[model samples]
Target chain A: MQRYKGIVAYDGSGFSGYQIQPNGRTVQEEIEKALGKMHKGKPVSIVASGRTDAGVHAKRQVIHFDSALQLPSERWVKAVNGLLPGDISVMQVDAVSSDFHARFDASGKTYKYVVYTGSIRDPFKRHYAAHYPYKIDIAKVKKASEFLTGTHDFTSFCSAKTEMEKKVRTVTNISIEQNTDEIVFTFTGNGFLYNMVRIMVGTMLDVGTGKIELQTIPSILTGRDRTLAGKTAPAEGLYLWEVYY
Target chain B: MQRYKGIVAYDGSGFSGYQIQPNGRTVQEEIEKALGKMHKGKPVSIVASGRTDAGVHAKRQVIHFDSALQLPSERWVKAVNGLLPGDISVMQVDAVSSDFHARFDASGKTYKYVVYTGSIRDPFKRHYAAHYPYKIDIAKVKKASEFLTGTHDFTSFCSAKTEMEKKVRTVTNISIEQNTDEIVFTFTGNGFLYNMVRIMVGTMLDVGTGKIELQTIPSILTGRDRTLAGKTAPAEGLYLWEVYY
Candidate 1:
């Protein structure tokens, strides 16, 4: 058996999430189905670096799958892309060691959340960005982002139904950047809990809008209650930027 | 009466381009309908810098309209934005002289056509760019762009159904740039004939793909027949970049 690693990019608008679900379509199921057809009806299963929720996009998502056929790297890239829908593309494919797993071998991951804070909505950017018409204090948001960084138990920032036994995760880097009319929040971490990044972005927005104080971040983490945090931002504005090993 | 000039942007995936068409919804019609509602049932007509064909996008399209009510600039911006659909946006609004006309007073217009030349389709960019799964000779396209620059009678580039009496147009600049996997064609001209920009891009692509030699450009222009030129490119990839007066 040959293990192939692929880098993928997708528009998550039509997906129910990364993992398979009974109610709606998923990126994994679509890719697996396409792969199965390419492998002569042989079913194939893929493991991803991380699972992204519905309406979230990905610029570069890593995945691994084992196939009995020894196909060339270029053939794997082209064959899978030809069968997949227009919203999904395999950017690169390479043969990796059999033991190199996509999810298990990953050291860290990066995500970006885009917010369009202009007074007027930009129709061209509507699907790619979250529109917030309220004026925000950038300084406060920056301060709050610093407080959220470093190792901590991020229970407040995670969804309440998270199945992970340990709520502690290390956020290595956090950045808040403002361009002409957009605000971007970038986070890099060892791992993320369910809905952690979205909740963190929401809480930071609350700080920028003066709904919450900058000093409240530490206490929010200590509270370990999802309700103590701000509302989770919509999934459309979030993107899986990259996966690092 | 006060004349207001506004800069607009739109994702043309939803509308029938910038002109008002009888059979389909148009960017102009939508904005005008919203303006009429704001003016208490009085219909308003807006004149744009130029007419864009169906499915063409715009980054900055200039337009002018007359209104009897002395509405504050902010209120006008907010009211129109409040009623317009998410596909179109009014980026800026300013008071202009009554003599100012968006079409007749325009000195130059710029357009950009984006082509994704990679083998795989980019799902996120499906509606925004043209996907050409073929290898192109970038050097030949760049040389052909140079040949297209300068004042000339672009009769062959104009669509056969164009209503203009004179096909003489001044192409001030033509630039073909390739960045990684995408090719961008930018053109600046005194004015473009109906479907002229799309035809130019198509002709250039033919040269880049070696379907037609670079030397064929002058002959295509001299022939003065639309059939001599290459096929007209699709409208989805074309963007009205800006207008200068």
Candidate 2:
């Protein structure tokens, strides 16, 4: 069997989540079903960089799977895309080393959280961005983001449901950019625990809005308590942007 | 009673069309329902600049309604928006003269059609853009658009189901802009017949793809036959951008 790497983009609104579940539709289930059809009823499995929550979109999510069939990269993309639904697309495909693992071999990941600060919520962006009607100081948001950058034990910034024993992850960069009424928070890190990016964005928003003091960021990080942080942001605003190997 | 002019925006995916019908949800029905609730089920009606086909979005659709209760502009916007669904938004509200009419007082209108030329369909843009995979010459599109601009009898570029008696309309501008994988065709005109913008876009795309010769644009206009033009573009890619007073 030859391993193939593929890049996928999906609108996560219609999906329950990225992982396979017994009751609801999932991205993994759809993709595996498409691949299985190509394999002539033989089930095929896929490994993603990580699972994304329901309503969390992906710009370029990476995945790897083993296939017995031989095909060119372009044909693989077209053939698989033809089988997939309109909400999920297979963008690019390439044969990879059999030893390469999609989840374990990943070096880093980048995520973006979109915040709509408009006085009125835009209908088109309702499913893509979190609406924050309160006024926020951009400078305070920037200052708080600085405290989030770099390696730290992000226990306070991770969901309590995370199964990982080690809560430590290195955040390589945190950048905040404002485009008109939308504030985009980009986070680049070596690794992220469950809901880490959403938690960080939530805390920073609180800091920007003066609900949480900027100076309290250090304590929040050091406390290592989930309750000490701000509320978890909505899943619709988050996007799994890229995976680097 | 005071006439209130409102600017609205909507994601047309869930809506049947801009007008109210016997079945299926519509933007007009939702707005009137919201206003009816505010007026204690008195059933308020609104008149839009024009009707858009099913799956056609609206960036700034202008509408006017008469209400007996007097209220501030912002309050009107907030009250209506609070009652409306997430897919529709009330952008602005202003008190206008009793003589003012949304349909009759409009001097011009602008519509935009989005075309996605990417190799792979983008999942996020599936509902917002029309996918045209073939390579096309932008210069050819621009040249064809020039012939379509200004005063012309656009019978060939109109739907066969149109009930309008006059096929003449002044197309003030037709600008083609390419942004990466998307081509946006913006058309400004005094008025448009049924499916005029979509038909024009379809014909221009054919010219760009060499399916139709550039010199035949004049004949298509002179022939005044719907069969002489290209196919009508999909409704999902068309947007009512603005209505000018």
Candidate 3:
């Protein structure tokens, strides 16, 4: 069997999450089902770079799987996409070394969170962006994000449900871009715990709106308490942008 | 009684059309239903600039209705939007003259059609753009659009289902904007017949792909034969952008 790596994109609006569960539909289930068809009733499992929560979209999620089929790269993409739902797409595929892994070899990840600040809600963007009705100070938001950059323990910015033992992660970058009525926050890090990005955004929003002191982020990180941070931002606004190997 | 003019936008994916129908839900029905609720079960009607076919979106559709309530403009927008579905939004509302009409007083309208030319299909844009797999010549499309500008008898570019007595209309502007993997065709005209903009776009696409001669647009307009033009483009790519008074 040959191992193959692929880049996939999904809308995530209809998916329960990226991982398979007992009842709810998932991105992994749909992709595996499609692969099973290609394998003629033989089940094929896939390993993703990581799991995304429900309603979290991905622009270029990486995955790997083993297959006996000897199809070309484009043919694999076409065959798999033909069987997949319209909300999920297989963008490209390439043969990789047999030992290459999607999850283990990953070096870093980039995620983007979109916030819509329009007073008038936009229907087209309802599913894509998190609507923030309150006025935000961009200068304060920028100042607070500086405390989040670089290596730090992100325990306070992680969900209580996270089972990972390592609460420490290296955040290499945090950038904020503001347009007319939208603010996009981009984060690049070695790894993120469950709901880390969303929790960070929520905490930053608190600082941006002057609810929390700007200098409190460092204390919150050292506090290592989930309750000390702000609420977890909604899943719909978060996007897994890319994975580095 | 007071007259209110409102600007509304809708995703149109879940809507059957903009007009009321027997079985399928429509934008008009949703708005009227909201108005009925606000008026305490008293039936209310609305007049739109025109009706869009099933799956056609609208960025700024104008409508006028008569009501006895004297709420502020923002209140009207918020109240109606609260009752409407997530796909439909009332952006703004204003009190207008009782004699003003949404359909009769319209002087011109603008429509936009988006075509996606990416080799890999995008799931997020599947419902918002028409995917044309073939390579297109944008220069040819621009040249053909020039012939379609100004006054002309556009019967060949209109649907045979039209019941209007006169098919003569003046197309004031036809602009084409091409980006990395998509093309947007914007048409501004005094009026359009049934499926006029879609048919015109379809014909231009044929010319763009060398399926039809570039110079034949004039003859197609003058011939007034529906069969001479290309097929009507899909409705999902079309958007009613604006209606001017």
TM-score of each: 0.90, 0.99, 0.98
Number of colliding residue pairs in each model: 1, 0, 0
- Which predicted model would earn the best lDDT? 2
Across residues B143-244, which tens digit of lDDT does each residue of candidate 2 receive? 999999999999999988888889999999999899889999999999999999999999999999999999999999999999999999998899999999
Per-residue error (Å), model 3, residue A219: 1.0
Cα distance off (Å), candidate 3, residue B94: 0.3
Candidate 2: stretches off by over 4 Å: none
Instruction: Identify the leading candidate in terms of TM-score.
Output: 2
Residue A141 local lDDT, model 3: 93
For candidate 2, write residues A1-245 as lDDT tens digits.
99999999999999999999998899999999999999999999999999998999999999999999889988998999999999999989889999999899999999999999999989999989999988999999999999999999999999988778999999999999998899999999999999999999999999999999999999999999999999999999999999999
Docking class of 3: high
- Worst 10-residue lDDT window for candidate 1 chain B reads B69-78
User: Which residue pairs clash within candidate 1?
Assistant: A86-B123
lDDT (Cα, tens digit) per residue for candidate 1, span A55-138: 999999999999887877788888889899878999888889999989999999999999999888888778788898788999
Query: What is model 3's DockQ versus the real complex?
Result: 0.85
Clashes of 1: 1
Per-residue alpha-carbon lDDT of candidate 3 for residues B1-245, written as tens digits (9 for 90 to 100): 99999999999888899999999999999999999999999999999999999999999999999999998988998899899888899999999999999999999999999999898888888889998878999999999999999999988998887789899999999999999999999999999999999999999999999999998889998999999999899988999999999
What DockQ does each listed candidate score? Answer: 0.66, 0.92, 0.85
Tell me the spans in candidate 1 whose CA falls farther than 4 Å from its real position: A22-25, A39-43, A96-101, A133-139, B20-25, B40-42, B133-139
